[model samples]
Target: MRLEFVENGPIRLEGGRFRVRVGEREEVLEKPRLSLCRCGASANKPFCDGTHKRIGFQAPGGVLEVEGD
Candidate 1:
């Protein structure tokens, strides 16, 4: 499984259950496709609760820029 950030929107998850550590807690998901919140306003915590759509999130078009080469 792999996780990819979708510009300004959410983190896209592909494949099966992957482990993630948050603070001291570990989270495992069973879904193959999921959108994770990045704006820190999601009521659902790790998952996107459609707050981005309500807040009018404008994700960058098809390009990702990583800092510091």
Candidate 2:
């Protein structure tokens, strides 16, 4: 299982449990791949629900590269 932050998209969760909490509400998803909406415009809440595409949710606005040995 891995979690990856894309350049111009939501947080990608793969092969693991995806969980989120906001205020008194919490959500846990057990999908293979999911894009979490960070733009806070998703009607589906914890899930991306294609809101990022509608509102044009940009990434962190930087270049990030990770290398492992």
Candidate 3:
């Protein structure tokens, strides 16, 4: 799967299997596409849940840490 860092937003996951792990919890995703939370404002924790849009989340320009790197 390839992760594209979208401008001023979350990381977009395109096509692949993913194991989303946060502490002791883990979620397996086999979807073709998905958006991950980066603003740390989602009520859904690791998942996007679309809270970023409402909060007007703007990503600062810098190096982005790759997920599952």
Candidate 4:
């Protein structure tokens, strides 16, 4: 299982437990691969609906600093 932040795109979660809850709703993934929204433009919350491209969303930095195992 791994989380990879693509170069200026959504974070991809592969072969991992993809569980997310926002308010009263929750998302459950049945696939081994999933792209999570980071640009905050996805119509599907917690999931990438490809809205970032239309909105031209950009992360301030190109690097992601993660500290966990």
RMSD of each: 4.9, 4.2, 3.8, 3.2
Runs in model 2 lying further than 4 Å from the true structure: 17-29, 61-69
Candidate 1 lDDT by residue in tens digits, 1-69: 456777668887676776777778897868777787977889987878878877877767343434554
- How many residue pairs collide in each prediction? 0, 0, 0, 0
lDDT of 4 at 11: 84
lDDT of 2 by residue, 1-69 (tens): 556776656777676576768889888877778776778898876677877777777876333344567
**lDDT scores of the candidates, listed in order:** 0.74, 0.70, 0.75, 0.75
Of models 1 and 3, which has the larger TM-score? 3
Model 4: per-residue lDDT, tens digit, 49-69?
888788887764343445568
TM-score of each: 0.63, 0.58, 0.68, 0.69
Clash count, candidate 4: 0
Error of 4 at 51 (Å): 1.0
Q: What ranges in model 1 sit over 4 Å off?
A: 1-8, 63-69
- In Å, residue 10's CA in model 1 sits off its true spot by 1.8
Compute the lDDT of residue 29 as modeled in candidate 2.
Answer: 70
